[model samples]
Target: MARLGIVALLAAFGLILTATSSPAASTLRAAAAEKNIVIGTAVATGPLAGETAYRTTVAREFNSLTAENAMKWDTVEPSPNSFNWSGGDAVVNFAAANGQRVYGHTLVWHSQAPSWVQNLSAADLLPAMRNHITKVMQHYSTVDS
Candidate 1:
């Protein structure tokens, strides 16, 4: 009788472990989906392209992505009218491939603005900012947010 009780207890424990240890049960993306919430992380372009582990984690865990620095003004528009869309595009492409949404970080921030933007006179600042926003939005029109 004692032997049967021990076997039953062991089986119960095993069943509990199996229920909790499933990949879908443990993943943030899946949990968020259950609650209709969006879980996201900031992705750095360098590791995103170079590290398999980073990419795997991002794809497995998050439903949305925000570029760490790649979407910042300094990185995207280092020079006026000379945009570099590579870094931002990499993030968008990865998000699309993973069935994840892309969240645009910022188009205008005091900290990450390029030198030319920073040096713009008061009269020139608004137009430059407007232009920057227009161009960036047009480029990333496909992003979810």
Candidate 2:
């Protein structure tokens, strides 16, 4: 009876070890890949850059990512003819490093639009929109879709 109890305990310990051994075995990315599906999430550049847990979860569980606020018009181009691509670039680079595809979020959304853009004249609005869209798209041309 003593030998049988030891064997049962050892088997239980083995099962626990196997269950906790590999995190990737239960990842959403792996499960999605099995079904020919792409799992993705919207990522904020702040947490992605600063938080190890956030970055690890994003990379481990998702096969694709979209910039949450990084790609917005207000964030990318806060002033007329001026651009800041750092946040957006960070997201794209992270995705690339993790073998994940990037989904471009938005070029011209009314919400979170810059004050300069909102104040543009009708004639100037179209040109400004075109310029913003063209520049953003060109910058991320190398990103995987």
- Per lDDT, the best of the predicted structures is 1
Q: Which lDDT tens digits does candidate 1 get at residues 1-145?
A: 3224334544554565578755544566777798899978788898889978778878887899999889899998899878999999999999999999999977899999998876789999898888888999999998877
Please provide, for model 2 over 1-145, each residue's C-alpha lDDT reduced to its tens digit, 9 standing for 90 to 100: 3224334544554576577755534656776797889877788888889978778878887898888889899998999989999999999899989999999866888888898876778999999999999999899997655
Q: lDDT per prediction?
A: 0.82, 0.81
lDDT of 1 at 7: 41
TM-score of each: 0.82, 0.81
Write down the RMSD of all candidates, one decimal each: 11.4, 11.5
Worst 10 residues of 1 by lDDT: 1-10
lDDT of 1 at 41: 78
Q: Candidate 2: where are CA atoms >4 Å away?
A: 1-25
